[model samples]
Target chain A: MWKRDEKKPVVGIFGFSGCAGDQLAILHMEDSTVDFFTSADIKFFHMAQSHQEVPEVDVAVIEGSINTERQLKELKEIREMAGVVVALGTCACYGGIQYLGDDEETFKERMKYVYGKSGETPEFLDLVGQPKPAQPISDFIDVDIMIPGCPVSEENFVPIYTKLISGLLPQKYPMPVCVECKYEGNDCFLLHGKFCLGPVTAAGCNATCPSLDISCVGCFGTYEGANYPSMIDKLKEIGLSEEDAIRKLKMFGGNKVEQALKGD
Target chain B: MKTYKMPKNVFPDFIELIKTKGKLFGPVKQKSKYSFEEIKNLQELDFDYQRTIMGVKKFLTPPKYKTLTFDKEGTKDIIDEPETNIVIGVHPCDIHAVKILDRLFLGNIKDPYYASKRENLIIIGHSCLPDDKCLCQSTGTDMVEDGFDLFLTELADNYLVWVGSDKGLSLTIAAGELLTEEISDEDIQEYVRWQQKRSSMFKTVMPSFKYMADIITLNYDSEAWEQFGEKCLSCGTCSLVCPTCNCFNVDDKILMNAEGGFRERMLDSCTLPYYSMVAGDHDFRPDRTTRLKLYYTHKLKEYIGRWGQPGCVGCGRCVTYCPVDINVITVSEALFGEVCETKEVCE
Candidate 1:
């Protein structure tokens, strides 16, 4: 914990290959932006400011997955400078949706299709070096804390930020989205024979989709002690085939769901 | 208890008089489902519904509510002035469930929050016919003699209102000309016939429900739990809808500026993950099977051992709402069936 005599903790916000939606989520905290700026010494945040320099910081809040060799090297440098590292958003924690396309052949083919005519490597690829399969930052560096969500919900982010600035470790929330869904008083989609992954998805979004009568897509990743086999069985009972159930479970569950499937 | 007969035509005037006592709330249809909502007048009330999504507990211990607010100056309890809320159309099983909650929250150790809410909130129970899902008959909560301020039993053309408390007497007195003390022989015969008819409508009954305490203990290691666990989602819908389930988790949330924060208590469930989790991430019931066992054994067996009554009121909320059909009836039947099949092996 920071002492009274100690200076305000300097914090750095960094992003890698995935969409910087997590940082945007933090920026979207209009009510807390002024307090956030005043509480911490934000030394390096390119999205919010310029003239960014690579400096040793108290905490590094990193978002997105390590998707390239160049980005991985930069991440190592950030790891060296920061005292504490926080993996923000689903991408930094579970590699996000890009984990589904993690195959070498699939990654290369998709890259070629998007940026190349047919066979030749794109100029950007040559400039940035060969792209790597999307993987969470924890695969490369130690992460002190992880805030997992597609866009790192404000309810989770704000409290974590306050704790980080106060030099306290953030608390973990292992509850599933169904907890919030029950609080919202929304009718259970599973009861209605609709496919909802809320039972296994990490909560913090306050059952946002389910409240609106939409099924949870597992964007927040698998919750702790999630019953994967049971969830799949339920999906199948709701008319989803075995193959489709596993595919849906892996949609945003990423490598974590894959690991559970292996254990099963 | 004082019994009064109110003719069908005079009920509207009595209801209008009762509305003046407090905020009138009753079961109202929301889409195909029913919920306890604020009723503007008699037209909004729908007593024909089987069950509301939530029960009287929603008024006592809400899903989420503030408990305390603290800042640099210290802390203050966040108890708002108790409002007199009169909830109508509660079923007898739900009334019994409230009585169970009262034993827990208002007995030797009182919960101030629940006590405050319970003191001000009035429960007006209404009669209900049994459906296929209802098991209140087996649980012996089909007809409640108490735990309600006023219980209105609907007859063919009139209502037999049983005043259970001074609050109920006050309502009757305020009703003045709308209520009559006259009791007819035909009214008694009609009430008896109505009770018989309602009793015959029960379709679901758990065999040896009272003996479940021993059965649950003997079959503690039965494979029935594993089968149910395999299908259980651990979504907590059972606890959420169960009127007798009253577990809660408290959290302190800091404001963005770090100047202040408030403590909040939200409804929690034993079946949900982390319900038995402590600091250092040590979870007592880490697997779904163990959690499922705790949920069933606690409600079905342990509650009986402690309070001489099962924690479940047999309201059939779980029977109606659980995505997978792993309710008290299925669980008790499965365990009982397992014991019967293995009688020779055990003996």
Candidate 2:
């Protein structure tokens, strides 16, 4: 470890297969972006900077989930090198929308549909090991922190970032988005006969979707210790099919939701 | 209370006068709905609006605000009071809501943040036609007695204005701009006639629980809550749209335990699932039915006990906005006629 750059902690940003939406959110933070940049010496960020050398970093903020062996190996290396590992989007922490094909067999079938026969790998595609269903980084390496969101909320991310830079541990979110929705004075979409996942899902985006008159698609994943079965039951009672309810629950949560259901 | 006669043609001049005093916020059309927005241009005012989606509570007790901004070594107060301003085209139902909020925020707690906005406010109420969804009359909030600075009733050729308080007299009308005559006896007659017309316009909700406080209190074990909870999304929209809902939650974020952090209070709704969740995850009201009952009890019974009036101002925003057709009127009707009976009758 290079102990010389003590003033600013060396940070790295990495992305795998999922959409780069969460990283864009970090870039979109106009007010706190400067503070974040000044506080952390970004050593590896292929999306934002030109530097290609994957130098060891003090803090590694990894976005997206691992669907292939190459990403899995890279994630293991990151966990070994970085002092702190933060799984920054829903994909990194859970298994985001990319985790739709829940079963390994289904995942392979879907992959086959996207990329023909497995024997021939395209020039653009690089696969080091056999592909599997999308999975959270924690499925392989130990994650120090998990800040989940389809695109992580700046309201939640900025404050937590401030603490992380100060060498302080940010508090884990145990509350649901319903709390923030109440504070926002937004009408309940579920009450409106729309399928809303706010009650069982996490908060911290200031209930942005509901505020704009749209139902939450569980972009933040289920809240810690949330009653997922009850939520699914309620969703069905309100007209959402069991299949649809489970789909909505797993949209941002992926394998994490399955793990939660199995009491993991 | 003084009275003034403003000709139909020069209403804009009076608007200009109010604008000069401070910021002018009035009813304006937003898409298919209506909203109370800042009137930068005089022509943006849409006095013909029935209701706004958000209540004026946004002015006095805003949803999100900062209480303190501090670094570890020091602290700074960030409760910036809004500028003095006039809220035009307020309905009597909404005015009563503002009164309830005053009682909630200013009476017992004396919230400095709320007081900062409440003190600088100038309310201008107007006559409105009740729609099918409006039930303000049923709740005794259809017409306010003394909250506004000015009250306007539109007539054929002129707008009959009632100067409610000394603040209303602050405006000086130009010689030719105003009628410059005593408000005629015809003015009073026409105003009273409109009051009678407005009183008769409302269609009374059936099975009306005149003593709502007692009805809700007695039905502690009512199954109506279960039925309602089945339809309840627990999104807390009812409380958020409610002019009388004054629940708030405060949280502190201290930076590294070094530099001072900040404290913030945000609008909270009782209907939300986690409203009563405590440390170690002991939820006071875990189910939607219990949460719904808590809201109804607070609005109909508890608030009445504390403030001598029912919390619900009968604005019908909940009814108009509810996706499952869960209006208070239908619920009250159901409670009295059928659902609120004991298990014997319910079974």
Candidate 3:
């Protein structure tokens, strides 16, 4: 009988500056937690445990965006060490909410609003560049896969992780959440004069908010063929202004919105 | 397909006939609103109700379900529950929603849980007399001609029943004793007139869906999103009440002391800040503006492009349920233009 390879595929979990909800969501997978750990060789995970070291790994699951100089440096090093990199959440995949301010002055103003005059002092690192606007991992590194949820859903994570471990790329869910929402049998909020984002946002969440008697806020990123202008009109008909509509789109899928604004 | 008419007096017998097979669910008054619930007596049925507070989607796809359960031994068990039941007096929008779901779960991969429930249950849809809040006609879903096993249309003093499938035919045959053989042409004409009148009652017609994708594409930075976000509480009410919002979160429920656990999938909303949080303390949609934008795009634009159908069916339940009353139609029209006056005819 042939002996099987004893070594397991090395895995690493990394985070950036955000609420850390995605990590908590992963930890919330109580049943799959042990299996997730046992399935791979977790070389580096800073949030779940205290011990941490940068080791070359087969796959690196990165969360958050390239916000600070330290984050950028760390991300570059992770890119060098890992063979494959997966942008694990909306923050890492689409720049999340931190990229709300597209203009430099607006971003600076928002920073001032939060930190005041004393906070304007920039933290400098000798080697790395200054902190620029927050951006998804794809802007800096080639992301092999992207799981785009505000906090990536466990429903998506399990299947995706399984595929990754087996050396297969998980298929992108081209369908929006409205497809699943219809399956769940909730009422459509739009007809009632309520605002909803089910049409343009990606569909992985299965329309949870609507089912619970709320409108979808589009935590998931935009689908491949999202149409923004029409949706804005729909919202406007329901009484929202054009400027407000675009701001909402920029909150999650800022990069895409920027591209769309540029008529790309 | 066969159509027949029964006297208004025969309605009681029809309820009794349905009761012979199993439980019958129909509209019932709960507090101030109408809802679909199990009826043991005919008196509990509300034949004249305008709409139900909740749609009949849950009977097919439940709020919380387990796709698969796994233990430490690596053994996995998928949960499947198939039950036989009947849903009476379903509205047109809800029936359309069910049909959309059928395309997703039954027509495609055949979700065992959804399939099992759908296969066993019988749907009896009702045509409504339009109310002020109803906009189904605007979205082209005011009347459903298919998807239900049997369709009911209320006439002057009776109901005109249309059998849609072999299952419906069998059920009609089983209830043959209660059904009347003779029906007048005037009753059929009156039913058609009522439907036409109902369609006309809807004051708003949703903009053509063909231009929806393009409209959303053009208004990516229209600046209207922030206005709504400023007022948004992020309470997640809009997503919860929407008929087609299907986002969910899965987690494991471990017993005390970490002895064992079962992975459970529960309803989750994108409106919540934690919904997009990642391991590295990063939140994808930290601001309310982006979250709100996501909800609108998914329903009006992204869904139609991907699934070949619009996500929203103009039910108006969200408007009714929202504390802030952020109307989707108004927002969409503001961003895209008036549905009636927009350029580029959808072919």
Candidate maximizing DockQ:
1
For candidate 3, write residues B1-347 as lDDT tens digits: 78877777878878788888766899988654667889988889887887665576667666666665544455365555544689899887888878777877776577676777788788898877766666676666777778888888887788888888888888889888667657777876887788778767776666444466677777788677877775554546566666667677765443221223455665556765556677676878777688888888887777787787677767777666554556566567667653334366421
- Rank by DockQ (best first): 1, 2, 3
Q: Which segments of model 3 are wrong by more than 4 Å?
A: A1-7, A100-130, B1-17, B23-82, B90-119, B123-347
Q: Write the residue-wise lDDT of candidate 1 on B1-347 in tens digits.
A: 89988899998887888788899899998765788989897898999988887888888899989899887788899776457999999999999999999999999999998988888988888999989999998898998999999999999888999998899888888888787889799999999998899988998876579788899898789999889888887778899889999999887777776667778898988987778888788999977789999999999889988999899888998998887788998888888888785755432
The superposed Cα distance between candidate 1 and the true structure at residue A141, in angstroms, equals: 2.1
- Evaluate candidate 3 and give its CAPRI docking class based on DockQ: incorrect
Cα lDDT, model 1, residue B17: 82
Residue range A170-226, candidate 1, lDDT tens digits: 666577888888777677788888899998898889999988878999999888758
DockQ of 3: 0.03
Candidate 2 wrongly placed segments (more than 4 Å): A1-14, A28-31, A40-60, A69-85, A111-127, A138-146, A167-264, B80-82, B172-181, B204-207, B252-262, B339-347
Q: For residue A249, what is the lDDT in candidate 1?
A: 87
User: Model 3 reaches what TM-score against the true structure?
Assistant: 0.60
Candidate 2 per-residue lDDT over residues B15-48, each given as its tens digit: 7778877788988886556677899997888988
TM-score of each: 0.94, 0.81, 0.60
| Candidate 2 residue-wise lDDT, A102-182, digit = tens | 686666677677788683446656535567678888888988888888789877876676667667667553557766775
Q: Which of the CAPRI classes, incorrect, acceptable, medium or high, describes model 1? A: medium
Candidate 2 chain A: 10-residue stretch with minimal lDDT? A1-10
